[model samples]
Target: MSDAGDKVARIRELNDNFRKTFAGGMMMMTASVAALPEMVRSAAWLKVSEFDAWDTGNDPHHEHDFINFELCNRNFFWKCDYYAPDMNSGSEDPSDPEKTVRVGLLMLAEDY
Candidate 1:
């Protein structure tokens, strides 16, 4: 293969790896939420903005802009947010979120 072909192949491989890793993390987040619904239940009193404001990033500008996928119980607060060069808009939508849900459901189905 030519140098450009090799580079393209490597980029494709890296992108695949990133997707798989992110899928796994999202599955874990969903499982934790479904397994402990009481803990991760949608807040009623607080406004959506308050929940969105929990994003604690090193970058001051990103704090308000960030959203967290949180799994909090009495003792633990597990959170995972997608990080990419671009905005995290892809994960914010539900249509594609089903892909993550399918991954979690498949694993959950397998375990039982």
Candidate 2:
């Protein structure tokens, strides 16, 4: 392959690796906290005030750094806005007794 072609291939590989590493870490963290139901439940209400796990802007992304997106229920991973209604918001009211909360994987982007 030409130099340009090789570079493109490497970039693609890096992107794939970035996505996988972020997803895996999120899953593991979720699993580890599985034993604590209350903690998991609390995670729902807790907004990610500060998180920079992935450096999406950087070219040479490492295993510990990449780009990611987080959703309230993983049902809306594509949605970037946090103000959007979550899946639970549709089924039951947060103030009601039938509340069902789920932890979402919010992607940590860099600050401008």
Candidate 3:
């Protein structure tokens, strides 16, 4: 296969893995929260525009080095932390760079 084809394949694989992780994360998050119905509704209504990427310049807290996305609905809000596998370290058994693990937490506005 061509180099471009290999790159495309890698991207597709990453996207597929992300989708699966995101869906499961959302499910577990809503289930764990106090307001299950409201959480589900808010999650269902989530929009891409509402997501705040943790590493982006918009995030003011540098101390928390995790990559996360925030979702909100009315007064309720939550953050989903995505732990992407590191690929740059020079080691024989490096983490799987393509794998992404996520944790979602419900929070109040003033929790930060």
Poorest 10 consecutive residues of model 2 by lDDT?
75-84
Give the candidate number with the greatest TM-score.
Answer: 3
The all-Cα superposition gives candidate 1 an RMSD in Å to the true structure of 13.3
Per-candidate total of colliding backbone pairs: 0, 5, 0
Model 2 pairs in collision = 54-66, 69-107, 70-105, 70-106, 70-107
What digit string (tens of lDDT, one per residue) describes model 2 on residues 3-110?
Answer: 666644644443343334432112223343333455533453242322334454533523222233344433211111111134423323222213422223432222
Model 2 Cα shift for residue 83 (angstroms): 26
- Any idea how many clashes model 2 has? 5
- TM for every model, in the order presented, reads 0.23, 0.24, 0.32
Instruction: Give stretches of model 3 more than 4 Å off.
Output: 1-27, 30-33, 36-40, 43-58, 61-74, 82-99, 110-112
Ranking by TM-score: 3, 2, 1
Residue by residue across 1-112, what tens digits does model 1's lDDT show? 9765564454333323333343333333335334544424443112222343333362242212223332232322322243332334434322232322222111122233
Query: How many clashes (backbone atoms < 3 Å, residues ≥3 apart in a chain or on different chains) does model 1 have?
Result: 0
